[model samples]
Target chain A: MEYAYYPGCSLEYSGKPYDKSIREVFKALGVKLRDIKDWNCCGATMYVSIDKIVACSVAARNLALAQNMGCDICAPCNSCYTILRKVNRYLAYDPEMRGKILEVLKAANLTYDTPVDVRHPLDILVNDVGLDTIKEAAPYRFDGLKVAPYYGCQLVRPEHHFDDVDDPMTMDNLLTALGADVVPFASKVRCCGGSLMTTCEEVALDLNNSILKDAEDNGAEIMVTACALCQMNLEGYQKKINKRYSQKHNMPIVFFSQLIGLALGVNPKRLGLQSMLVKPKNLKLIPKGMKVEA
Target chain B: MPSIPPIPEPKRQREADLREAFLKEVAGIPAGEKIKNCIQCGTCTATCPVSRWMDITPRETVALFRAGMLEEILESRTIWICASCYSCTVRCPMGIQVTDLLYALKRLATDKKIYPSRFPAHALSDTFISSLYRFGRIYELELGLRYFLKTHPLKLLANIGFGLLMIIKGRMAILPKRIKKANEVKAIINRAKELEGV
Candidate 1:
């Protein structure tokens, strides 16, 4: 499968592991990812919170760019995927806004009249790439490596287009197919407070505390998520989470793609596993070293 | 002199206007909401993970909007406190897009500029939008620096250690990449603002 990739801002920065792993995994799966040229941020939750028209326009520009690619736009970041998908839906559903979005796009010499298929990598990996094909490429079995699949809030909520909103099992099933022990994970769909970590520290930390505690108590050796922000919020803020809660949480939060990359025999360094804030302690069972074209 | 209760704001017209205004304020509201079908059941409140922190619970946010309590809704921290989790949006039996409604409310509050200066999250949106236009992409380092400087200088100092660790670990991209079409992005944004005429 070929896709127009939108890595968004988080993936280029704090969520670098997601970018690296996603690319490596997709490459190993025989999928081609084309970068959307001069793509802007998807306006995110912040822009929408500020101005609906501006945010919609900002998101629309990328959809416009991807339209020429003649393929679905696949984003690893949940916010990017959600914003792109939501804005596209908004443009299609409301004629008035759609007209305005068209005019706004014209200002940049762009146009988008069709619905954009903004896909999450997990959705693409499972449905588009198919689990059977993914399993066939795997050289390493997880040996029931206790894993927690954290879906965060955006990828499957508001619109359960690809998975169940309340109890999503796509990630759970995908990891299981790789021979990892998927935990019950009560907080799988829970919020990690997202950007709220920067603004409302206590609230975000409290939320992360529950997520970390839930996974740890449930016997998860590591937590894998599809959202860049979720990974960064949970893993990036571990020190603060530990300090605030007075709990020693040395959990290795990883991108779901990295786990797949490991199973596919991609080198840990290529998966950006070495950069994890809390080093991965449970990946010993999986063999590494795939000759990647990076 | 009889103390007239300020005639209560023409109750019905203002309520209609808020709903009608919402149709234009944000996308996702065009299909219309069964907001009138809301039984004040507080289902949205129960589903909201951040309800406890909100000054105006999700249930009241709807009720107040219907009641034309724009002042109360605007002043309350409920709109900003929302994490946009959409748990409430999914659970609302009335099919009210509660999260999108909050986004509309945030747009309204931002336009009126009534939110307190110390409100931390408010700084996030405009700065983020501005950065989106400026570089055609986000510069997280600058965004974080500006956010903390505006909201809490102490947090900025606290984050230095964390920032250093991230850079060392190769997770933090210290530099922001400016897109080649930044001018076009700015032009489009400016044109959008003019067209929006907010």
Candidate 2:
């Protein structure tokens, strides 16, 4: 399978591990990520709230760029995925908005036909790669470790359109197929308190603590999420919470793709597992019979 | 940590009344077309994680919207509890978008200065300020450290530990800098101010 890629600004910088691992894992599974030439930021989280026209124009710039290349686009960041999807759906139905966005794009020498499909990397793997291939590729089954599949805000929220905004179990099913036990948690759609971490540290810490607490309460040793922002928010903040509060809990938050890569026999170091703040302690947690070569 | 004072009742009203301004601010959005069509079906409430801890439901907030009780919806602590799940929009029978409404409400709430969100969401503006003030782009390490410094100073030390670990792993850059067009980014922020008139 092939897709036009919109890495957004974050993926190129601090989120390089996410970009690196996603490419390696997908390539190992025989998928291609064709970078969308001349792409810009999705306005991060501010454009949506601050300005509709600018947000749509910025997101459409990437989509128009991808459509020009004749490929469906994939956004690894949850915010980017939401922005692209929102603009794609918004411009598709609203002619006036579409016209305005197109006019804005024309000034930048780009035209969007809304030809490209805006899909998350998770959707591509679960829907395109299929569970059978994933199961066949798994060198070790994640049998005993209980995991909570976190959908976070961007992917499921605005539940106006997209997959089930709540009780989303697609990732759970895929993970289950890879042989790990999945936990049924109600806070899957909860916010990881993203950029709020900066302006409001106290509140963001509480938000991060709440997510980790819920995961710990649910008996999950690891939390799996799709958005790099969510992963960073949860894992990075967990260390601070643990230290400040003198908390003993340390749940390793991982990208779903990294877990899938592990099951497929990819080395953890190669997948950037060592770089995570909340490192997985005690490999003995994995059931004895379900050991991957990694 | 310094204790934050509670919002005085009269001061709270000034803060609560800002939702009207937010609604007016977003009046031109084509996306806001369904604001009036919201049916209180409780799908958003059913899906909202914050509903468990807060006093009102997401569905009730929609009901307040349909009733033209904009102030009540904005003033509700439930508004602060919103995780921006968008579940309300996804499940709305009338297709009223609820998540963006919450975001706009947050802007209004913050403006009113009555919003008592003492935790994480409050840090967003600070993160943006640090990013804009230094590197044109956000520095996750600084943002992360600054965030932890609020309630958990010890966590800041832990972040340094993690940063050291990341550096040793060759994952993070020792020096954080802006990419090309750093000035253009500030222009975008300036443009937002011009448009919002804040």
Candidate 3:
């Protein structure tokens, strides 16, 4: 299957591992991802808060570009997925706003004709690729490694088109099919406080601390998430959270793609595993001296 | 004990005027009129992670808006403190769009210039937008440095160790990845701003 990939800004920087692993895993699965040419930022939650019309217009530009490719777009970042989906829904429902946005896009020589679907990678992997195929493609098993699947808020909420917002099970079921033990994580859909980590540090820290603590309490050795911002907030800020709360949780937060890559026998280096701030200590799960043949 | 004269109560006419102005402002925002549907259910406040830090609870903020107390809500620290997580928006039984209302209040606060100066959260929003406008993509290092310099230089110095760690780990790039044909992005932004009359 072929799809247009919009990695968004985070995947280039803080979310590099996600970007790398997703590409590798998709390649292994024989799905072709053509990068959306000349894509700009998705105008994340921050831009939307400042100016809704400008944010929607910015996202609309990316959609118009993807429409040129004649393929449905797959965005790995939840913020990008959420914003793009919201803008599409807004333009589809509100003709007044659509007219205004169209005028702005006309200045850039672009037009969005509602040509394609904007999907998150998780949605494509679970729904389109199918779990049976993922299970069949795996060369290695997780061997009962306990994983907490964090969906975060954006992927499911404010719109429930993909999965059940409150009780999402796509990630959980996908991991289980890959031979990992999926923990009953209660805060799966909780907000990671996103950009608030830089904006309101205390609140963001508190919210993250709760998620980490819940995962730990449920006996999860590692946390797997689909969104770049959620992984960044949950993993990147653990040090500060431990310092502030005097807690001793050291769980490694990993992208779902990284775990799938490992199961599919992709090289660890290709997935950018070493770049994680909190390294997964369960590397011992992989049999010693076993590596993917080049 | 000596009898004290009764304190004069707030005039009813002034209260009505404030309420009317608040309603008018709410009507001006897109989908903002749904805020009047709020039943004072504290679901929003309960769902909010940072409600403890808010000067006015999300439920109370809606009530204030409904009462036409625009000045009080506009001057509140609550709007600035909102994390925009949208937990409250998803959980609201009345489907009040609590998070969007907070964004509306934030815009109003920014327009009135009433938010606390040197507030890092508020400054972060402006810095983020400016970075997007200038480069068509956010430059993380530039955004971080600019935010620190403007919000808290001393704290910036304190966080240099962690920043350096990020650089060493290759989590951050010293240079920004710019989009090709940046002029197109600029044109889109400029046109959108003009459309908004801002």
Clashes of each: 0, 18, 1
Order of candidate numbers by DockQ, starting with the best: 1, 3, 2
Best by DockQ: 1
**Model 2 misplaced stretches (Cα beyond 4 Å):** A159-162, A243-246, A282-294, B1-31, B37-47, B50-83, B91-94, B105-198
Question: What are the per-residue Cα lDDT tens digits for candidate 3 across B72-181?
Answer: 77667788887666788888987777777787667666655667544547788788888888788989999989998987788788778878887887888899877887
User: What 10-residue stretch in candidate 3 chain B is worst by lDDT?
Assistant: B21-30
Off by over 4 Å in 1: A286-294, B1-4, B7-28
Ranking by TM-score: 1, 3, 2
- The worst-scoring run of ten residues by lDDT in candidate 2 chain A lies at A282-291
Q: Model 3: what TM-score? A: 0.92
Per-residue CA lDDT of model 3 for A1-294, tens digit only, reads: 989999998899789999999999999999999999988988887777677778889889999999878788999998899889888877876778889999999989999876578998898998999999988888777766899999998888777868987898999999898767898899998888887777778888999999999999999999999998899889988888999999997989999999999989898899999899998987534442355332
Arrange candidates by lDDT, descending.
1, 3, 2
**DockQ (Cα-based) for each candidate:** 0.75, 0.22, 0.58
Assess the local accuracy of residue A175 in candidate 3 as a C-alpha lDDT between 0 and 100. Answer: 85
Each candidate's fnat: 0.80, 0.23, 0.68
